[model samples]
Target: QLHNFCSIELGSFYLDIIKDRLYTMPADSIGRRSAQTAMYHLLQALVRWLAPILSFTAEEIWQHAPASDDSIFLQTWYELPELSSAGALNDADWQRIIELRNWVSRELEVVRNKGEIGAALEARVELWLAPADYDLLQKLGEELRFVLITSDAEVYPLTEKPAEVAEEQLGVAIRVVPLEDAKCGRCWHRRADVGQSAEHPQLCGRCITNLGDGEQRHIA
Candidate 1:
């Protein structure tokens, strides 16, 4: 049954169904990214079987799945993580990380509102931490910055005030600054535009469908 279920059309349809349900459900029901990532794992499982049948389509979808690298064909087949005995991730870790990510999004949006537009992960950021959380921040500075969508980040001394503060004190503050002259017109994030016409200024080839900034262009 599992072998039979793997195919490009089937895999994509499965993702569509799960994504639709996840987005349509109440926010309190589940985390959207978590649901989507679970869908990615399912798709990855099917990718091996589907790659020979639907090479192009599988690659296309795989590229959009952030968890994947260049080509699913190049990547090894998915193996279910063995969780039989003791080693396993618990819900609390996921919850804590989710909360941190949400807070990072909120803070990043606030910084972006202050004319930082399109500040992506890998942008230099300064994080102000509470004294109690300073050591933790120092230990995970790179990881936190990467997850929070910042270039480089440093956990500053506790007294630094964040531009936006949550209703309930997060005891953490973040500041993001876009690197100068590193803008890609397409994704608007700082990166080498792999697909730019000679005439275009830093446009990503992969993001051709995302033409016209600040304008809603329906892809479907």
Candidate 2:
């Protein structure tokens, strides 16, 4: 479980997925702030989990972590936040979403191996999803790209699956296409509105907004 939390949750999802938002965006950006806050909790929890197995190392980390003055011996297991009932995506929904995302990754991999795109964000993914999947993804709207880690993503209800792209597991038909737009210098995502700001020629509109009061973000 600890290995899974470290490899999948922290490495794959949190840090790797939103590396750009965490590093490139301004400190005050809501998305950046949200990522930082989540990381703080994760760090604290992980360190506590390590205390029993790696006592010396965990103690070292605890010194630099929050409540540094307190020793790790005094702390109990980190209590994770309970799943919220406030209209947030539950665990099951996220599991389903991960399955669908894996499907999309396979499609992107095929295109990437062919040298059509250098980065995952260099291509856009379009999905013809089952009714359930479409409804779940539509909740994210444009932010779905963040989850897919793609430059752009479009999800449509599956009317009829395409003959070329075959899939049965998730009932998703995926298409990967190279984006022709200029890539954002900061975010490195290809976007058509990249040069809109006169002051920041290489940034996307979202980055521009983030530079000021920060962009509102609910989920990655």
Q: Please name the candidate that would achieve the greatest lDDT relative to the true structure.
A: 2
Q: How accurate is candidate 1 locally (lDDT)?
A: 0.53
* Per-residue lDDT over 37-87 for candidate 2, one digit per residue giving the tens place of the 0 to 100 score: 788888878888899999999999999886566799898877877656898
- TM-score to native of every candidate shown: 0.39, 0.91
Report clash pairs, candidate 1: 121-149, 121-150, 122-150, 122-151, 123-150, 123-151, 195-205
**Quick one: RMSD of model 2?**
1.9
| Per-residue C-alpha lDDT of model 1 across residues 1-220, encoded as one tens digit per residue | 5444544224533343343334333343333445555656666776766788889977887888766787878988788655444533344543454464566567668767776656454366665667755664454534454344454466776576654733225676655666664555544445555435675656544344233222221110
lDDT of 2: 0.84
lDDT of 2 at 147: 91
Worst 10 residues of 2 by lDDT: 161-170
Q: Residue 158: error of model 1 in Å?
A: 2.9
Candidate 1 Cα deviation (angstroms), residue 195: 18
Local distance difference test, per candidate? 0.53, 0.84
